[model samples]
Target: MEGGSSTSGGRSWSIYGRAEITARYEILGSVGSGTYSDVYRARRLSDGLAVALKEVHDYQSSVREIEALQALHGSPNVVDLIEYFWQEDEDAVLVLEFLQTDLETVIREGKRRDGGIEVGEVKQWMVQILRGVDACHRRGIMHRDLKPSNLLIGADGVLKLADFGQSRILNEFEQIPTNEEWMPQPPTIDQGVSHPSVGGYENQAAQEQRPFNQEDYLQQLVDFKTRYGTNDADKESNLQDGDASCLATCSTGDMEDDPYKGSYSFVAEESAEHESGTLTSYVGTRWFRAPELLFGSVSYGLEIDLWSLGCIFAELLSLKPLFPGTSDIDQLGKIISVLGDLTEESCPGCSKLPDYNKISFNKVENPIGLIACLPNRSPSEVNLVKRLVCYDPASRATTMELLLDTYFTEEEPLPTPLSELKVPSTKTTHDGGSLGEFYNYGNMESDSDLEEFGPMDISTTERGFSIRFS
Candidate 1:
């Protein structure tokens, strides 16, 4: 991971308390750059082994990514972390096994068969994605920002999960329902003057001023945890313990007989370090986001990733975004147009989301389903897609369940081996996908003569640029 006696191409670079950076590796060229870091392809000076160097501007993000990647080093579908060294006081450099390109680039550059990738290739990539994500979830981690761009591919065509910047560690054994602020308890009459009420405030309704109240929402949320929440049996048992966190007046037998051995303290006592932010709304790129996230549920779990996997699979199969919306509101509308509408009965606790009650959507009666949209795909394939993109987050397929699906296991259309795929893996990002923010053709700011230009006018207004790609 570090220095040898080898000299790096007649130049010298240095880091704090370490050997010169140039002494270990030869900088090849730049790959890409994101908000926090720049990716580069480099070769180890000692053995000439190719490696990817990510020069990070933010130390906090680098440390968080290092912790996550180190925890998931051996997973076949995940990227390998080679080593890291400091560049400056607030900057650090991460060394990783260099990959050729990413899945997004493959989809963009690969020829479209019937307007999508070959069904076999899509299956191969989807299975690999689920396996890599499973590795993360099994280890109690969640890749919060899972999209095509972050999923890298090597020359051997092995898909690796990269970019741990937005990942989260979920310690279920120690976690409470929501990280919320506890109200100051009223004093007792024993000390000095007459303190208002002790046991009284606990029974009263919460004031509307509080953003989230344990008295109203916390207890209600516990009551809403039906048998259908998580797809995993083991995780389901863990969620049952979540009930004990809210019920303060449970019988002595109920408290003693709890399966978790009373490890779960009250939800109120848990620290308010919940979602990555103080108030978790949406944190991912808009298109791949799940319904629960759109509804603004801060208490959502790993199933949200499953929803994203569904969207990715659809994009791979159709060679276009499944639900590309102009904004958050439009995104939700597009989802309903496909999955129908959501009600409290449909998703059970969806209404409890912070923003759920804030907006309303039209109910779609005969919305399009996966089978019709992916007409080229087989019935089994369609079923898996339906399960993965289910309206209820509780019902989406877990990574383990997805691996066991007949569509993947059966021999109807075997997955094309990675080495056999024709697409060349090279350095790229969602292949000009950044143009999405700049060119939302469906909802451009300026008006156009639709009769004269039609839908293509959004991108082709200036020239024949978009028509050439389409």
Candidate 2:
């Protein structure tokens, strides 16, 4: 959106389709910074409303976050994007709803409590998280980076999902077009030939045309992938011939060759040339990263988010991280040490992951299960985590399923009322005057924290700061 000249005297600044940012809102102070963006707390001049000004430096990240927010406009559990500003030469600025604290702070707050967060409170947070995740997954969007720091809490004690810069629209048909005016129109088809169905050709004139149901289509694809796993040799051929729309609308990674290769492939095959079409494996915080991602699997799906959800739940139950690894290799080692050996029997088609053969570890004779990770937790609570934190991506529980599980379904420890839930303030400091790691927007870590990790691009860099739980 373009803007006119501002009321200010000197330089004519156009911002947010009206006056300059300084004219519209009073900048309070800087809150957070990341590789691609800087966040500042601001107050709208007209309404005196508190909002976050996220000045995005990276062009691609700006577009991604904007698109994702636009697509998820009315989701109650997702963060609200109030407005944005983008000009020819200057950087893009997003005006978001201001949130006081995050889930990380809530978990820390719970630690100080007599017995940690109550069961009902934990269930409430999980319910909100699942609702947000289910909204994204149902719409064919992958948050890619789901962690405690990224989930924010407002004054009303409601949790909202945030930090969408790393999000992606997986379905090609559902992709939002940048400029519809510039988009090429599809060619007209002949009237005689009928569109091909999953199995055979159909006579369009003879049959009643059914309206396209994306939800049903996606569910079928999930059921198909779950049963077939990644070992079906004819999977690609079947998708190509029987249902071309499935590949375009439902497929996640490379179906035939490497199941771990992302759909955004630049290279068709494994060759001497630089690896093409490979998504950056290092996208999330090390503590909650999925094993497939740790093993450099690019062609992942919503399952990665489920794994992170499991980690978050475990922390809520125990008031500590389930696996706090020092590095990527150590992260995998920690998971292996708990879940036993990573094998084909444990996770079918796991060997197909790009880095499965590269990373090796000694098999644990007696692996400590999720129960050990969450001591004193009830069987239902532990079972809830086990449903998601597993070796197989397909085996991981979907948000819908988790919401229906006995842990959430049972009436005893019900989700806490919103008024009963505690909400921490962002201004709250710990360890004297130091600010907590997760009390700001954009969910970024300082450059000094990642200096030893080597240079990386905005998309590939480690996003969240790690809190090593001894």
Candidate 3:
């Protein structure tokens, strides 16, 4: 689909009335815009073939995106880069295969109170997303920013990974080790017995089982309330006032702001061994940013993207972000409050992060309960997401492991094919008519990244806060 000649093979229409690229591609209209480029629907003069032309204005950023697409040329579940060429005082013209729309549009247009999309549709999209990520990882690359917007759809409903603006090369990254000593192992099948030495030590491994006692649990809760400075009168009053009011009065003793209060120490344990491109920390979008990234981890690798994927899956299930913090500090507060108080065991070496102790935060435990946030998800589905979005990036599931999760093998909600997706296959973008509505680019002056932060990569850092990259 070269533009050297017109349909007559002599000369083409000069600048299809927009830019020099119009000589080759007939500009239809604007499709969408990124931080560094504006995508337009166009048709080639040689064959009248439809394509997407991304007008990349920044040189360095464009190079990174080009390198990523070139490395993943023929990989499965990834978009194809048709052709690319640059002009001297203008933007670089990147011709890509046209997609019907992106996953972001689908999610937004279909938002509902009854927990977003159906289970089958989410399962299908999850499979496709993981497959695309696996392809990238296998080739030693990391698609740093993988929000819904980056997942594109075709006329036939086939989904593919697109927009490598924030992607990075991993030529010498460490392999995900099979010797997962740090990961928890499945319990062995064995007989269980009660021990008189311990208090009510009943094991599920045994043939017989006994349900837990609720009265005793309440007594323990009362003790916990007592230790935190609440009186017995308050507890009695709470019982009469109802459970919701009772919980509002409970305290956590004191915040963990004092370094000497606990035996925990900030220990340095390098999680991954990436050789280069390691310092630039701003990775995925704000709400999807991993705990390690918020805590200031500059050496993280592919697992960071996995955390973002976990958030995306959660959003698909609930029709909202799992952690939608307005700022970085607020983001951490939301994570601990919803995911339960993080410890060294929960996130090994988390204290060693550069910004770990930079601010003082009151210890906020999960009041409504961790599982309460995901009430509708099955146990296996919840378990899978918990592992991927866990505090420790090193322990996150690889793309292949996620794709092979038992949740996919279950009999109930099977994945739906693209042809069955209830969305139109030929629609384009509608994000037009506003300056503030631009895509997430490097808001370095405000928010940044071409797409590493992604379309919804809102700023999380407060003004004048001394936080490291990412």
Candidate 4:
């Protein structure tokens, strides 16, 4: 069969060069596009059920997402993965449940309809978001990116976490050895042997006819580990640091005299697969990035997600981003402006961060507190945010703890009933290509479509470094 094709409401949809998938599901329309994948809304031919066909272009991202989804199967508030097709030397196509809209859309629509989302509605959304996050954390998974766009909502008013490309399973950290000799080698699958398929099976009698060689298996395992596993040098260095410990935005030039000030394109860097016990700091959007991540701390945990949650919660209360910074340096400047300086006292052990000393800043005498960020909002709302957005990751409240806070219990305006939620009308995927609607929003995607931040200037004066925000 020619790669499946269909047209809906004068829009055409086609899946290119995948005959096996085409035979099973009919491509409906493009949902969104990302740096590593393109998501399409499709229909299963067997039962006429609608599902999302995620065409993952990056092999590592695909593996991470598939592994996460399988482990998180049946989790509450987590997106459901129906099935997937992975053939050698080709992109993996994951069939997932299609969610109508996302939290970002809800926030935008609420802004347009009313001045802000109703207090009760905001509470309900937060509850659902927390539930999704709790599920991930309980399973030892850190959704490195937890911005509004990644939180999907269905007609049933349920919020499900999606986009596991940046997710990391903490299990590897537990498995990593403290000594060189104790390092365990990874299992190697022989190339000559075809991997088992999810839908098909091999004949047992034919497989039994083949001779097994223990010595060859051991040699191949050693060879594979030597080529792909961690090198002796990396192992030694990484282990030494074990005692110690640890997105994307088109950034403005830090200096006014910089030549690349006016013209800067947002180039998304490919996420590198990290060695066990280490993580890439380049994860999540700049606005929701945690202070540790900002300071270049590689060793982190679920607390990073908590900080992003705090940002998202703040946005819901105010209907705008808590700190909308243009550049990495500027982002830190905005945060420090509101939360004061990052210090040993404010955040114990913060100085130990990799780049904490590298990036210095002028102390803020009068820091604009979280309450000031949420004007007219109840104290409960501010308390909820304060527990998450802090200098110390260890101090950030866990999702389960947040779920039990008075914000959700004993509050005057309780969480809105799920049945009463106004489900957003599902918009058809754009035929004339739009930015990352299915996975992420393009550069323009944010709570506010306000004009981009003006050019910022970073001064390296003897007093202290400061990025002038316009």
Query: Per-prediction TM-score, please?
Result: 0.67, 0.71, 0.66, 0.74
Ranking by lDDT: 4, 2, 1, 3
lDDT, candidate 4, at 171: 61
Write candidate 2's Cα lDDT for 105-208 as tens digits. 88878878898899999999999999899777666677877888789889898889998877766544242211111221111222222111211222133344
Per model, how many backbone clashes are there?
Answer: 0, 3, 8, 2
**Residue 258 in model 3: lDDT:** 22
Off by over 4 Å in 3: 1-20, 87-90, 112-116, 174-281, 367-370, 425-470
Model 4, 339-399: lDDT tens per residue? 9998988886676665565456666899998889989988888988999998876677777
Per-residue lDDT of candidate 3, residues 1-470 (tens digit): 22221223222222233344656677886665555566777898889988887766555456566666765665558887766765443345568888776676667656732446778888888898998887776555677777776788776777889877767666444323221112112112122221111112222233344454545534543443233211122222111111111011111221133222232223222221123323233455667777766665544556677888888887776666787755454566677777765667777666655455543345554344436767777787677778777776656777766775677766467887777876644443344222211233222122211223222212234321232222
**Candidate 1 residue pairs in backbone clash:** none
- For candidate 1, which ten residues in a row score worst on lDDT? 240-249
What C-alpha lDDT do the candidate models reach, one value each? 0.58, 0.63, 0.56, 0.66
Positional deviation of 235 in candidate 3, in angstroms? Answer: 51
Q: Considering summed lDDT, which 10 consecutive residues are worst modelled in model 2?
A: 237-246
User: After superposing candidate 1, which stretches have Cα over 4 Å from the reference?
Assistant: 1-19, 111-116, 173-282, 428-470
RMSD of each: 19.1, 12.8, 19.6, 11.1
Worst 10 residues of 4 by lDDT: 176-185
What lDDT score goes with residue 19 in model 2?
Answer: 47
Candidate 3 Cα deviation (angstroms), residue 62: 0.9
User: Per-residue lDDT for 1-470 in model 1, tens only?
Assistant: 12211225422232222345566877866565555565667799889999987766554456567667766655689888776664333245678887766777777765443445666777889889998997776665667778887788887889989887666665442222222222223222122211112212332223343454436543443433343254333443322111111122122433354343244333222222242223222245667777767654545566778888888888787677788865454567678878777776667667655445444554577988676677677677677778889867777767766776777778567788887875554544333433221111122112222122122212222211111101
Better of 1 and 2 by TM-score: 2
